[model samples]
Target: MGIFQRLMKNKELIPLAIIMTTAVAGASSFALYAFQKTDVVIDRKRNPEPWEMVDPTQPQKLITINQQWKPVEELQKVRRATR
Candidate 1:
């Protein structure tokens, strides 16, 4: 029998085609998912969400005893001592 006839009548080709199609579909799906980034940041400052956590970078306003306005914009400083 010719090669084409043999392949056409072969029972194994059906399973092989199914396997190849499944592999291609899975790879395409994975590639699509990999390109999508789910990180979305939403600022709630204008809405003033009561349950939302506050960012420490906002300036803390302080008042001195001498009636002076002191804005203490303190960012937690990490100091490493040299050996």
Candidate 2:
């Protein structure tokens, strides 16, 4: 008999055979993908430009406040009073 006729003859083995086949296919595909080199180019050891380097001793001024803003103590007092 042919392979198909032999497979159908063993009813209990059909599910097991299908499961094994699927597992093998999935594993092979995953292995192929994992072993292949990635398309993305990554530069792990890139050097910063001379201008980009900053002195640790000198602090960088990100923002300058022209006027002194009032504290949130007033809002906190109002919330506490409501509670």
Candidate 3:
């Protein structure tokens, strides 16, 4: 007969059909959520900060610190001499 009638004849298949239906629905929902793209918009004009007002096209000067480098052999010699 119909599918519903077949399922009604076999009562044990009800739980199996419910579990399969739930699994299929869960998988479809997860696939839709995973592949959806979300757009983010930022408004900088409402209340702008000092850093946000700076021109992005202009080059900014960076502060540099002077540091001396020593070779690994020299560092090992210094450590051994100290001991």
Candidate 4:
């Protein structure tokens, strides 16, 4: 007999088969979404070219304090020095 005929012959298994199919489909879709690669940022400057590089001669830019920032208690200066 065909698979459909076999499935129909067993009424009790219909719900089970449906649940399993749904679970599998849901898991597969979630897996596909979770494992998909993120958008890549490509550096096209030296594609198929000779490799030549140099160390940075200057320091990186300094970060300035934001006006809206607040300091936490742990970072605050201690009022009394401990022995």
Candidate 5:
């Protein structure tokens, strides 16, 4: 006569009902997760840093080194001599 009695009488409908319930719960949880906004702020466009404004069209300039390269032994000796 009641909902439970009806469900017990129709056993095949139980699996269908369970599947529908699970699908609805999953869909609502996913909707909430996808739509919610976070507290984090992103302001890269309003206040741009010096490094962020590089011209991509121009060729990159190679840095010229004034100091000559020393031998590995000398560099190791200097490092070991230092505190």
Candidate 6:
């Protein structure tokens, strides 16, 4: 009857057709995104200015925030300690 009817009659082909369609759509979408840029007015071939100046021997810092929650004394059970 139709092309789809022939594919349905052959059980191996239905899954392959679905996989091929999905692969083509995914690849085309990726290619389109790779070419389009929306923000800056600068030409792409020229070198753009750096957003931050390079600093050697800059001082480093570390900060930590700890939040611990403990059970209320009403929810606690007293147990005898054994050494």
By lDDT, the best candidate is 3
The numbered model that scores best in TM-score is 3
Query: Worst ten-residue run, lDDT, model 1?
Result: 74-83
lDDT, each prediction:
0.53, 0.62, 0.64, 0.55, 0.63, 0.56
Q: Write the per-residue lDDT of candidate 5 for residues 6-75, one digit (tens) a residue.
A: 8999998899889999999999996776444232224556645533344434323445345444447876
Q: Scored by Cα lDDT, where does model 5 land?
A: 0.63
Model 4: per-residue lDDT, tens digit, 11-36? 88889889999999999997776544
The alpha-carbon deviation from the true structure for residue 38 of candidate 6, after best TM-score superposition, in angstroms, is: 6.5
Each prediction's TM-score against the native? 0.36, 0.41, 0.43, 0.42, 0.41, 0.40
Cα lDDT tens digits, model 2, 22-60, are 999999997786544232223335633332343433433
Can you tell me which runs of candidate 2 are displaced by over 4 Å?
A: 38-83
**Stretch of 10 with least lDDT, candidate 3:** 35-44
Tell me the spans in candidate 5 whose CA falls farther than 4 Å from its real position. Answer: 37-83
**Residue pairs in steric clash, candidate 3?**
none
- Cα RMSD, each candidate: 18.2, 19.7, 20.1, 16.5, 18.6, 20.7
Candidate 1 vs candidate 3: the TM-score winner is 3
For 1-83, candidate 1 gives per-residue lDDT tens digits of 97558668996787777798899999999777654422222444654543234333432234434354443535212212321
lDDT of 3 by residue, 1-83 (tens): 98789899999999999999999999999677654422111444664544535443443434434544444788679868988
The candidates, ranked best first by lDDT, are 3, 5, 2, 6, 4, 1
Cα displacement (Å) at residue 82, model 1: 20
